[model samples]
Target: MGVLVWNELSRYVSLTASAYAVWASFWGMFFRKFFWDFVGGILRNPGGIQCVHISPISWAFVLMSRRPSPRARVFITVIVKVPFIQIMTTIVGFFILALEWPLRPVKGTRFHRSIPLRIFLLAFQAILALLFYQGTNASLWSLIAAVFYIRALTLGESIGPWKEQRGTVGQV
Candidate 1:
């Protein structure tokens, strides 16, 4: 039970982290000038600026522009450069992870074993990918983060359940 909980938690974290990375990339690009100005202002003089009239948009851009950890940045950079990572992430997240491995149907299950559902998932993933495939560094990084998130989900699912089952077998 502990392992299962941990597995689920890790999956949620991965998904969240990746989603954030993608969102940050998009946000940073869209508000490039504002983000930089905000960051520079914060760094140059942390408490010097009086609250004259700052817009919520400016505040959001500042918050979004904060630098990520070095390891995370490197990981995102490397993952984005790879070609197949995006496709794999989409497939894993939408098809395998989302459906909880319905291809190998478990006993006593009825509704989850539909081929059409899987097909729809695949189509949805493809469409999403197409929509986001603007040739930009930010988009690439977003893809990389998405892949990491989905891969984490896959790993958590594969390892966590197995460990739980093994523990139960041992007890029995």
Candidate 2:
């Protein structure tokens, strides 16, 4: 199950190799989709957004903490909890990149004007996918990417830098 979920994580791995990875990841998600459908007892059911295992932060905290039949509740909790953990880490990883490396150029120059953030993210995501499996834990990579992305996105505009060059206070 973990491998299936792990393999399916590509759907969220939109950082790089987007075109190709998308298809692969989509199929991966499809597997989970069915499992979720079965467990949820319906198709297209949705779950709440919750923080990782440190509950009180979990959406199901009240529903899960106590129950009439602990076994059924436990099973239900595991199903949702597992996915929650995966998504949490994935989001954390994405932000890690978002905060540090938006990869935007500061001035209207060669790379800034030419490169699209999507293309760059596509490549970066691909690299991260590889790292996700072999690099270490997802949390580690998530933090790494978060740092890289935040810097790039936040200060990537070249025009803003140009404003400074022109002695204008461009509050970017």
Candidate 3:
């Protein structure tokens, strides 16, 4: 029972964390005017950037922009309502739902039949996240995820910038 309870909690934390990531990606700013600057600004001052502890799912990832440094309750309150963040999470949620391909069920369904698998996948992801959140082995996994995320983000941006620099997609 203890394991099951922990599992469920971890799963919720995973879902919440995923939502937060999408939220940050979309609106860490632009909502209540979340201002953040690397060169040192009020929104994201020199020390504003720090790892925020997200309970049950420790060490998720919070940019910690501190233009004003509101209280915890207030900070969370604002975050959940941020326009960009909410929209981003909504879009992600919709995408995941759409992945189920509910529109055309018959005619030899493929991914539709795998809905259970999808849920399980989500749960498994939650478990992995839980490990990072509270396990003693958290640091290593977190570091790895961070590195991979950075590399992917950099590569993704590079593709577009490279294309622009070449003066068109294939004209380079």
TM-score winner among the candidates?
1
In candidate 3, stretches whose alpha carbon ends up further than 4 angstroms from where it belongs are 1-25, 28-47, 50-92, 105-108, 124-172
lDDT agreement of model 3 with the native? 0.36
TM-scores, one per candidate: 0.25, 0.22, 0.24
Give every collision pair in model 1.
none
Task: Report the number of clashing residue pairs per model.
Answer: 0, 38, 2
User: By lDDT, highest first, what's the ranking?
Assistant: 1, 3, 2
Indicate which candidate wins on lDDT. Answer: 1
lDDT by residue (24-142, candidate 3, tens digit) is 43433343323222223223223433444355566565445343344433433444233433443345433434433234433134543433443444433333322211221222332
lDDT of 1: 0.36
Clashing pairs in 3: 42-67, 43-67
Off by over 4 Å in 1: 1-4, 33-172
Q: After superposition, how far is residue 134 of candidate 2 from its true place, in Å?
A: 8.5
What are the runs in model 2 whose C-alpha is more than 4 Å off? 1-82, 103-136, 140-172
lDDT of all predictions: 0.36, 0.35, 0.36
Worst 10 residues of 2 by lDDT: 130-139
